[model samples]
Target chain A: MRSVATNSTARPDAIDERILEELRMEPRATSKALGLKLSMTEVAVASRIRAMEAKGILRVVAQLEFRAAGYNILALIDVMVADRKINEVAEALSRIDRVGSVTMMLGDPPIIVQVQAADSADLHDLIVNHIAMIPGVEQVETNLIIDIAKWRTGSAQLHPTSLPG
Target chain B: MLVDDVDLAIVKELQKNGRSSNREVARVLGVSEGTIRQRLKKLEAAKAMRLGLVTDATALGQTAAAYVRIKARPRHARAIAAKIADFPSCSFVGLTVGRFDIVAFISATSRDELVRVVDAEIAVMEGVLQLDVREPVGYAKHRFDLIHIP
Candidate 1:
């Protein structure tokens, strides 16, 4: 999604706000249903959605039930790489099916990758065979996620939203 | 709940366009509108599907993002994770097994705002003993879930 102006300045009209809220609550909602809820025609809701998406206000992402896909093991790996090769290493990490997301940082250990594996052996294989083979990687530290208690996303829920509110 | 190919197909279509109408989905996938609606209802009932917003925080003006590696006092890791989760800026928080007991992903709009979260919110948490804050420049590959598995 394209970054919008701050939520305040980028505030949509009352109707768009309602659309966003509705989409947020039900990502699978049809424009017809949304139109009915807003007392508008399906065509109206569909056009508004297209406009919002063009502005980077909303993005539709496929949410796979990863656990069911047998990707149960989750780990956060802090990677130290040759300063110049961070981009290459990050791109390689992204291609791996077991890797969830890679975060490239500013300092010493420049790469932080969130990985999901099937088990301990799978993680070891990723580190030794896949990630290590990627050029420029210096060191790898894997922090196994023992438990996940809670989670949330979207700019509206994070701290920045809190401060401005 | 087992998701058949049709169910996966519906999820795939909606994943690409959440607001896609059942009629449209049926037309593209060559299924009847009734079948599409039935599969969607079953998937939703099974709690295997949900709607959400996914974004790259940095792209949204959240330039400061760091992995806060933390050590908690024995059983206090759970409490500390809950604290990190409650912080408005913290996007993802979880307990880990390694050098650190807990690892969290937090982000803020600016360096100053990020520090405030670390200093005031994370540092002062009851169980946090020590932490290493590493600000990542960007996320080369960022996605919350995988729907179209090849």
Candidate 2:
């Protein structure tokens, strides 16, 4: 699996940022269409996109809304583990199908993960039967996401402008 | 939002390659281009899914990231969450239940930016009673493409 911290010194130029902005708004827009909108030739636009992809900076993918996809319960699970086995437990958690994202954090609860389940029962099983059973997992805290006020994906990275005060 | 096997297959296919043309998907799935097009239209109309570009912020220099759990004053959690969500650094803002009333995920260009947003901005908000920031030492997995379909 690819690490989240995949490094690259390459950066997008002004033109590339404009292309990304356009793609953010219309992901499926063809190169020819984007060329027309951005006043660039189709080959130029397509080549720039290809360069970004080659550099591992951008990926166009089908983003699924978990709640809408029928996995109603979304919870953040923080796990306290035996210090020596923290990495082992995190790796195990990452392999689980229900676990969405796993990050090893600093301090008391060394691991945190976003998990989804079809219902409360499944979530219970995941925590009790699956996660809790993992070796070195001393404790678990779950925070259920009740409502999401904002979930901007890739858009915010380019436009770091804050909302009006 | 009644998704069938075909819908799931289409989504699964696109999850692997979002830019796959309708004809390519049709060829792979042994279906007509029209069927692939119609299913995609239906899935999108229901807001079940969408094709989009996911940028690697780490590659783009936003290396610092963290999850902030907050305890807020009663009845103000949702409002505070909405405000927090508006911050450009915050990628996710959700009202949660358990130890904290709100949870937010933020990524910034540097550690200093992360500290500024969490300390100077979020902590000083009126309704924020308590806040705990957890910075990732390392990420074992961060999969946005995969989800439990069941």
Candidate 3:
């Protein structure tokens, strides 16, 4: 089996903080644009970014606007899987189409699954028909989202200063 | 001043349509445009509200995203968490009272990158005792579930 090596973990510095902040706001921003904003040369910005990526401090990704992409129905499903079959069920879920995020929870049934679909019918088919078919899945409960208060990926959540209380 | 019914109505509308112009929101909420502007500015200043930008990771070549749970030395939990959070892959990290001490989300463009993240990056965090990782196959719902205006 091919396994990646992990070693030499270290903390981040001020420059790292600035670079991460820029990427968080706009992941697709060009190195030159980022450089202009940070007052660093484009080459410098590029190298710093690459270094961070290498160090695992920064990752540039394209995040989908699922709703805009035509997936309208959103639901949070909590599943109670047989303790022994959690891995099996999780692997099965990973194979299902349009399964956005399958999170194994810490408390209770021990798994929380998040799914996005085109409509209620699509959601129904995925969960009732497909997900439930997995051998280890014992029980499932879903909460359909009515509104979104705060939602963003990891980087976007970081704010150096405290938010107004 | 405490937020009253009118202010609450304005907040609810803004939460739904963050970029809606003050004039437009005012028309919908039956408030003056100036009132909308003042409330919004106050919200930002008070840190009670923020504008969010959502994107597509798959469109940007991030084909893989997963959550990794790590059990670490209790004494080194905070230090390890701070270090792990520095990684871009560490999307959501929290000190949990469960089987795992820390949880993080990682994004990768391919199988190789995902493996690299698990093997080379997360495995090396100081004081980590054990690691369990899971890849999310689908998202049922991961939005902010806010209903009450107050």
Candidate 4:
């Protein structure tokens, strides 16, 4: 698995930002079509995009609808770890594919993970069976999400010069 | 799915109202119930359309969620993402087109837990930097787009 540079910075160029905006609205937008919209050559658009993705700045993934996938439960698990063993515990939890994100805190007994599974049973298996099994894991708290009033993806605005509608 | 115009119409209707029944969908799309069934089956088989159940996250008492974007050492992003995906708290993970290399959604029971997650776990993870966490104040609308059949 390739990892991004810990301190890497990505500043999307003007054209790159425009391309991203179009793709955000239509993930399936073709490079030729996008280039036409932006008044750029198809080869230019495609090459730039390919480079962006290769640099880990862009990813084209199938955004599956959550509810339709039979995953009706969303929970956030707060984890406290033994300070010295924080990495040990976190590395262990990271091995679980079901856990979506793992982040280490700059605090005592640090490390927290974001997990999503099928339901209560799946969540339990992770927290109870898998997470607890890792040595140096001090505590794990589960919080099931009830309402997500709003969720947004992508940039706030693709262009500041002018709005495209 | 090899969608015809009629099938596309059915999908459009459902995207508007997921709970719509086959009969209702057919009525809205000006098609027959049998046609709806066949199209739906084909779509499912082709992995074009997926059916899902929706619920309110707040009603369930699992409130306070945020997206944590983490940038790991160049050689560490994929391994880090794989490791993070194992926890029960992660909702989704993706390598993205932004300052951060990986992004994920995490929900907590309370603000305190949210802090624990950010300050404790995320900050200490090796090869992680540029951590940007944002909590959504309100969710305006959510929709699934239909595939445009050629």
Candidate 5:
């Protein structure tokens, strides 16, 4: 799987930002249509998009409602592992199908993960049979995601690529 | 919102490529173009799904991603998450169990920016007893792509 880089100082230019915004608004629009909106040639827009995607700079994803998918349980697992085996434990957890997002957190609980299960029984099975069994786990704390009351996606707004003066 | 079989098929197709034309989808599904159009319209209106171009913030320049664990009064957790969700830089905020009452997933252009978000915005929330910040180098699956066609 290609990993989209989440760390870099490189920023998109104004044209690229406009392209991103346009696509964000109309993800289903054809490149030809996007070109018309930007007043830039279709070839320029298409190539730029292709290049951005190849470099993980541009990503288009469709999100479905998880509850509708029968994944009623969503959670965040904060794990404290043996001092030197953080990556080892994280890597092992990532291999599990249920574990979604795994990252090395910078503080007390050095690792954090997002997991989903069919129901409470499955949640228990995962923790008891899967997570707790992982070697080097100094401690494992599971937090149920009570509600995703509000979630605003941060896209095309980080590290603003200041418009040229 | 358990979608019907046809709806699941449409989502399956869109999951593969959100940009698939309605006509093309209809043709592939052995249905009229109008049917595909109507179904898509319903999905859009109901907000059952979203089609958009998303990117890794790191690819656009600012690189750090962190999860802020907030210890607070239980009643205020959801309210606090909603407030943090209003922050433009915040991508996700949720009320969680265990070590923290709430978790806010926010990204920054740099280390300094991350710190400011933790200090100025999150730490100051009313009823918050304490806050913990943890940054992950990468995510194995940072997505909302899961589905159940039943």
Candidate 6:
């Protein structure tokens, strides 16, 4: 998989923003369809998409609603780790298939992760056997997400100004 | 809403490249384009899957991000989470069970904006008992895929 451009200072332009808006509405719209709607050639539209994707501005991806996908539980785990061992514990936790995201924070529980499990027993085992067993991990606090009021992908959050009316 | 092997296969293909045409995915998976199309429609209609753009916020200059955990009064967690979800700065707002009643992920263009949202907007809300903010210094992994269904 190609790595996202992290250091690029590029931002999407007006035309690019329009393309993004169209995609946001119809994520699978063909380039030909988009070009006709946007009054640009198919090639031009596709090229702009490629450019923005290369700049790490955006790329289409499939997002799952975990509950419907057979995952019964979603939880955030806050892990307090030994001093100077945050990165080590984080890397280990990230390797777990059940751990969806691992972020090293700047506080007491230096590592936080989003995790999913098939059920309560699965979640219990995951924490006790996988996460808590990681070296340097002192304490683990599990915050089971009961209901999601709102959740947006990073792309949606970044371009709120271009939201469709 | 039962997810079969075919549904998982289709989702896996789209997870890799959401823009992959039905014909392309069918060709790769050795299934008919109509089957692929039909499964995608079903999965989407079931709200089991979403095809959308995912971006790197750091590359776009929205570098400041933090996770705010809120302790809410009894029976107010859901309402507080709903209100917090409306904030432009919060990308995620959920009612959780643990030390905190609600948890939100806030992203802003700068650290000042992040702090302002946490202080002036979130902390001052009614029913808020306690609030803790944790800023991520680094990310070991942040996969968009929730889990490997297969």
**Candidate 3 off by > 4 Å:** A1-78, A82-165, B1-8, B144-150
Candidate with maximal TM-score: 6
Q: Which candidate number would show the highest DockQ if scored against the true structure?
A: 6
lDDT tens digits, residue span A28-128, model 1: 67788889999999998888777656555566554565555566687889888874478888888878767767777878678899887878899899999
TM-score of 2: 0.88
Alpha-carbon RMSD to native, per candidate = 6.3, 6.3, 13.3, 16.8, 6.5, 5.4
The fraction of reference interface contacts (C-alpha pairs within 8 A across chains A and B) present in each candidate is: 0.54, 0.66, 0.03, 0.00, 0.63, 0.70
TM-score per model over all chains: 0.81, 0.88, 0.51, 0.49, 0.84, 0.88
- Number of the candidate with higher DockQ, 4 or 5: 5
Query: Model 2 over residues A1-165: C-alpha lDDT tens digits?
Result: 222332366778799999989988888788999999999999989888877776667777776777666788889999999745788898888778788777889886799988889999999999999999888888999999988787656622222211111
> 4 or 5: which has the higher TM-score?
5
| Residues forming the 10-long window of minimal summed lDDT in candidate 1 chain A | A156-165
TM-score of 4: 0.49
Candidate 5 positional error at B23, Å: 3.2
Tell me the docking grade of candidate 3: incorrect
Name the candidate, 1 or 5, with the larger DockQ value.
Answer: 5
Model 5 chain A: lowest-lDDT 10 consecutive positions: A156-165
> Which digits, one per residue and each the tens of the lDDT, describe model 5 over residues A22-110?
88778777889999999988888878777676555765555666666567898888888985578788778777777766777655677
What DockQ does model 4 achieve? 0.04
Candidate 6 wrongly placed segments (more than 4 Å):
A1-9, A156-165, B147-150
* Cα DockQ of the candidate 1 complex: 0.42
- In angstroms, give how far residue A101 of model 2 lies from its true place: 0.5
Predicted candidate 2 versus true structure: per-residue lDDT over B1-150, tens digit per residue: 657899888887887667778999999999999999999988787777788777867557788988999999978888889898889788788999999999999898999999999999999988899999888887777766533222
DockQ of 5: 0.44
Per-residue error at A106 for model 6, in Å? 1.2
Which regions in candidate 1 have their CA more than 4 angstroms from the true location?
A: A1-18, A30-45, A152-165, B55-60, B146-150
Model 3 residue A156 lDDT score: 21
Residues A1-165, candidate 3: write the lDDT tens digits.
222223224334687668767766765466789899999999988777666544444444323234533566656566788745575676677566666555555445466766778898998999889989888788887756544322346432111111111
